[model samples]
Target: MKDFLRIKVLKMLIPNQKKELILKQMKDKMNKILNYFKNLVAKIRIGKANTEILDDITVEYYEKKINLYHIARIEVNHSNTILIKPWYTKILPAIEKSILKANLGLVTINNGKLIKIVIPNLTEERRKELIRMNTRKLEKAKIILRNIRKEYNQIIKFNIIDIDTVNIYKKHIDIVTREYICLIENIFNKKKQEIRRI
Candidate 1:
């Protein structure tokens, strides 16, 4: 039976249930923040180690390798270049062809050894577009935070949880969401600065 009013005892159902529900809400916020900055993360993956960009690339032209992420290592060098070194030289042309099809401003220059790709600096127009994209992502993450609050309210509405306990959960959600938002904004600020450096 469902009780819409009176001591709803949301926690009384099970101690673990209450804890798990709270944890799930927190994870929702975490996922939102992670997804928001996913593209930015890909851009900043420029490190000394050999890692691939286009990690999600798929191959359809020839059944040869199926995807560049599977055959080549993507290394981001400097501020505007991606290095693709196929594990085997035989796939050099295939790699170049794949990149060309991507049309991501990638120019394939093979010195009979390795393929070097130059990621051009984002034009002022592109930078503005990226900024706008991230701002929208942040806004969506905030909206997710609001939805968590609504779920908390549902518990309170039916007296499922006591006032003190509900207050505690509310405070925890607020604190966690604020921290996540801060992280997202900090990342955005760093990327924005990089974009405008030139």
Candidate 2:
């Protein structure tokens, strides 16, 4: 209701051309934030056989460090087991060592030909801890959004002289910020559910 009243009081102080440019810039930044948040959530382990967990793990191959997925064929052999078959058998030990060094709390079994990663079931306490961690990440993303909104609002305030026009611009920023925040929250909730499920 307050926002509606403010909009009614706001005059046509700024040209639509300038307003659209500012809005486009803000939307671009918010979309980048949303994409980054999605990437972070994808890395969280959900007690299932998922190859995305190994996205950051790197193996030394011929004096070059390469991502695990680049050198091997990773697949879910079962609900709790990830089977990794390296293109070259010589890299098997290196891959196994890297997995152990990553400290992912997973068990790796090397059987000469391939490596098997057994994802452990999340204990009740561990699940709670993961939920907490997820919540922190969600909060961090929201903070980033708020900071972006603040930066844009400041820009609008400095350029626009009318107080009502400034308020209208700030309200638009708030609406976009809320939309992105809601998107991040939905993703966080889905991940929380995944962590809680057995």
Candidate 3:
């Protein structure tokens, strides 16, 4: 399935259009999945948040910008609050929608351009439920990664991809997998710490 010579050549050659095209496609595939899970875990961190809303809320802070997700921060004093600070003073309504859409069940109280979010303390049952939800998210990321791998395999099986190319793809897969796992685990640890607090 691989031309050993071609693989060696690809290594030495600056990626021409053909190589660039394949590399771009593979990178896109990798980013699409990696970004999705990272976003999910970020949302999960917000979800596990008992007192703040960090889910999918964005803010429009620039001059007359429309996309609210363009700006947002991830900090709440004492870990029980989320503050949404917008750059634009007029987009409170839109920012509110982003926060609600995030669906962390946090209420946004607007103070001029600043929105305050108070995170609630998690009950034992709720903590367990959040853990379960995180597991599902991780599984979904795995499935997506597999689907991308399958696509790469298709290219390999068709004899279009050389060994070097396949190896490169495999390397990306390994990197993404490790990065995402670390992110997910960090969220888990944070939530577990929160749940353990009496």
Candidate 4:
């Protein structure tokens, strides 16, 4: 009789444990998706010269591909100019070539010692294009969020102990989903404002 009661208690606790574990996993995955979206947004220039704009550019040095930041110092010399000074002057041309190939709509001036890039003012048409691109990225993030919700719902439906427990988990998942969606919307709005700013 004692053993039967203990078994019953264990069964009750296991489902709760599983629910907590699933919630934690869902939150971790959602955070990763949010960070990815933030990185994508960071790469979109807003008519300013930012060091992060060159973060994706890779230069060939010593017969190996290396990130631009690893070989040189990137700085914003002015509101619209970026200066890249390589530690070894020999790689100046290589860095210049990498930036050119990046096709970021910027012009590079290599002066033997350092490379300079001037960010041009965005025309009205370019601003519209950037907004459209941003909208696409926002849609992609929304789709990822929806997929995560679906996965959690499936897990809760299949593994939960009873209908009541399943409802609890579903409610919690809905709340979390709402919170993350709001966060993404706020980020998108801020980026749009930045792009439209003069």
Predictions: Cα RMSD each: 6.7, 7.8, 8.0, 6.9
Models 1 onward score TM values of 0.54, 0.72, 0.52, 0.73
lDDT of 2 by residue, 1-198 (tens): 975454433334334446777778889999998999899887877777888888889999989999999999999999899999999999999999999997667899999999999998888987887788779889999999999999789777766888998898899899989999999999999988888775
Give the per-residue lDDT digits (tens) of candidate 4, residues 63-130: 99999999999999998999999999999989998999976778899999999999888999878878
TM-score, structure 2 vs. true: 0.72
Model 1 stretches with alpha carbons more than 4 Å out: 1-39, 45-52, 61-67, 73-116, 143-159
- Which candidate achieves the best lDDT against the true structure? 2
Residue 100 CA displacement from its true place in model 2, Å: 5.0
| C-alpha lDDT score of every prediction, in listed order | 0.62, 0.86, 0.59, 0.85
| Tens-digit per-residue lDDT, 1-198, candidate 1 | 454432255545435466457657566757665664656444533222223456645654346557676766777775556677777887777777776875444456887678887665567776666667657766776676667656655654444346787677667666766776677677777766765674
By TM-score, is 1 or 3 better?
Answer: 1
lDDT of 1 at 136: 71
User: Which lDDT value does model 1 have at 106?
Assistant: 49
For candidate 4, the TM-score is 0.73
Candidate 2 weakest ten by summed lDDT: 6-15
Predicted structure 3: clash tally: 7
73: Cα error in model 3, Å: 7.8
lDDT of 1: 0.62
lDDT of 3 by residue, 45-162 (tens): 4333332224334444544544443554445555566676766657767787667776554667888867777665666776776667767776776676667666555554454446
Candidate 3: 10-residue stretch with minimal lDDT:
46-55
